[model samples]
Target: MDTCYLCGGLLELLGTLGRLAHYRCIDCGMEHSAGIDNDPTPTKERTDNDTDMENQGTSDSNHD
Candidate 1:
C-alpha cells in the first residue's frame, strides 16, 4: 500500500485527476498525486473485488 512520504501516514486514494492519481494522508490530511506506472500490459478498469483484495493486503497468487 502507498504511504505519505511526508508524515509516513496511511494514504487513501482520491481518484484520478487529469493524468495523475491523487491520494490523501489519513492522519495529516496531506494531498499528493502521481502518474500511473507505465506497465507493458495495458491497465484494466478497477472492480470491487480489486478493492477488496487491496484492503485485505493480499495480492493475486499468480504474481511472483
Candidate 2:
C-alpha cells in the first residue's frame, strides 16, 4: 500500500493506466501519483470497476 505525500497517511488506489499509478489520500481526498518502481503487468481493461461503482449508486450531487 502506498502512502500519501500530503497527509502522511496510507493512500487508496483510485485509478491507473500503463506504468502510471494513481492514488488518493483517503483522509483528505487529494489525488497524486504513486512512484513507479515495480510496475505491475498490463491488464485487460480499465474503468470497468469505475463504471460499476458509478452505476451502483447515485452520485453525491444527486443526494438531498
Candidate 3:
C-alpha cells in the first residue's frame, strides 16, 4: 500500500491537478501528488488505480 512520505499514513486519491493525481494522507492531512515513473513500455495512460476509480464512477470532481 502506498503511504505518505511524511507520516506513513495510508494515502487516498484526492483528485488530479493537470496530468498528475494528487493524494492526501487520511491521518495527518498531508497532501502530495502522485509520482510518475519512467516506463519502458510504450503505453501512455493513467495509473491503474486511477482507471479503476474512473470505471467505478468515482472521480475527483465528484467529491465536491
Cα lDDT tens digits for candidate 2, 1-64: 7666667667777677776787766776667764467522323344688788868856567535
Clashing pairs in 2: none
lDDT of each: 0.67, 0.63, 0.62
> In model 3, which runs have C-alpha deviations exceeding 4 angstroms?
38-64
Give the best candidate by TM-score: 1
Task: Itemize residue pairs with steric clashes in candidate 1.
Answer: none
Best by lDDT: 1
Task: Compose the digit string of candidate 1's lDDT tens values, residues 4-61.
Answer: 7777888787788577777777887777767776211112446899888888956466
For candidate 2, what is the lDDT? Answer: 0.63
lDDT of 3 by residue, 1-64 (tens): 4677777788777775566676767887766665454211111346799878778954457534
TM-score per candidate, chains pooled: 0.52, 0.50, 0.48
